[model samples]
Target: MLMPHPKDMRTLLSRYATARLAHAERQTLKSATQLDDVSYTLCVATATTEINDALAAADRILAQPPPAASSRP
Candidate 1:
C-alpha cells in the first residue's frame, strides 16, 4: 500500500479535525428542534469522501521512489 508523506498526512489530518470541530460546534449551537436532521449525515458523507481522497493521494505518493540525495561534498 502507498503511504503519505509526513507533512501531507499532518496537513490532511488537521483539515479533517478542523472540519469535525466546526461541525460539532454548529450542532452544539442549535436547539434540538432547530437542528436539521440531515446536516450531520451530509457532513459525514462529505468529510468521509475528502478524507478518503487524501488517503488515496498519500498511498500514491508512497508508490514513488524517494528523491535522490545531492552528491555535492
Candidate 2:
C-alpha cells in the first residue's frame, strides 16, 4: 500500500490515538462523532475503508523503517 508522508502519518496516528482514547473513556456523542471523523480520515489516508483495516494499514506503513517508525497493536 502507498504510505502517507512521514510527517502526515505521524499526525494521523496521533489523531487516531486521541480519538481512540476518547472513545475508550466513554462513547459520548461528541467523542463518538470525533472518532468517526478521525477514523474516516485515517481510513482515507491509509487507502482503506474499514477502521480496523485502516489501522492495520497505518501500522504496516509505520512498521517499515520509513526513512523512521512506532509500536502499535
Candidate 3:
C-alpha cells in the first residue's frame, strides 16, 4: 500500500480541521433558536475539542516516517 507524505497528510488534516469548524458554525446557526448564549458557547467548545483531537491525531500520524517501499524481483 502507498502511504501519504507528511506534507500531504498535514494539508489533509488542515482541511479537515477547517471543515469541522465550518460545520460547527453552521450547526450553531441552525440551532440558534433552541440554544441560549451559554448553550451556544458550550456547543462551540465541544466542537473545538473534537477539532483539536482530530488535529492531534493527524499530527501524530504525520510525525511518523513513511513506510519503506518493498523490493520486487
Candidate 4:
C-alpha cells in the first residue's frame, strides 16, 4: 500500500477551506436578502466572525515552518 503524501494533504485542506469560504459568502448574501433588521444584523455579525476566524487559522497554518528533508544514502 502507498502512504499518503503531506503535500497532497495540504492541497486537500486548502481546497476544503476555499469551498467553505465560498459557502459562507453565499450564506451572507442569502441572509442579507431574507432576514429582518435584527436577524440580518446577527447573521452578518456571525458571518464576519467566521471569516475572521478562518483567516486567522489559515495564517497560522501557513506560518508553520516546512519539514526538513531527510538525507539518506
lDDT of 3 by residue, 1-73 (tens): 3444555556565555555565567766634433333333332433433545545555666778665555321
Tens-place lDDT per residue, model 2, 1-70, is 5567766778988998998899889989989999999989999998889999988887777776755234
lDDT of each: 0.46, 0.83, 0.49, 0.44
TM-score of each: 0.37, 0.76, 0.43, 0.35
How far does residue 34 in candidate 2 sit from its true spot (Å)?
0.5
* Local error of candidate 4 at residue 59 (angstroms): 15
Candidate 1 vs candidate 3: which has greater lDDT? 3
Count steric clashes of candidate 4: 0
Off by over 4 Å in 2: 67-73
Tell me how candidate 1 scores on lDDT. Answer: 0.46
State which candidate has the highest lDDT. 2
Displacement of residue 67 (Cα, Å) in model 4 is 9.4
Tens digit per residue, CA lDDT, model 1, 7-73: 4444554555555666667756443323332333333433433545544555555566654555222
Give the candidate order by descending TM-score: 2, 3, 1, 4
Which sections of candidate 1 miss by over 4 Å?
28-73
- Cα RMSD to native, each candidate? 9.8, 5.9, 10.2, 11.9
* CA lDDT, candidate 4, residue 8: 39
lDDT of 3: 0.49
Which model, 1 or 2, shows the larger TM-score? 2
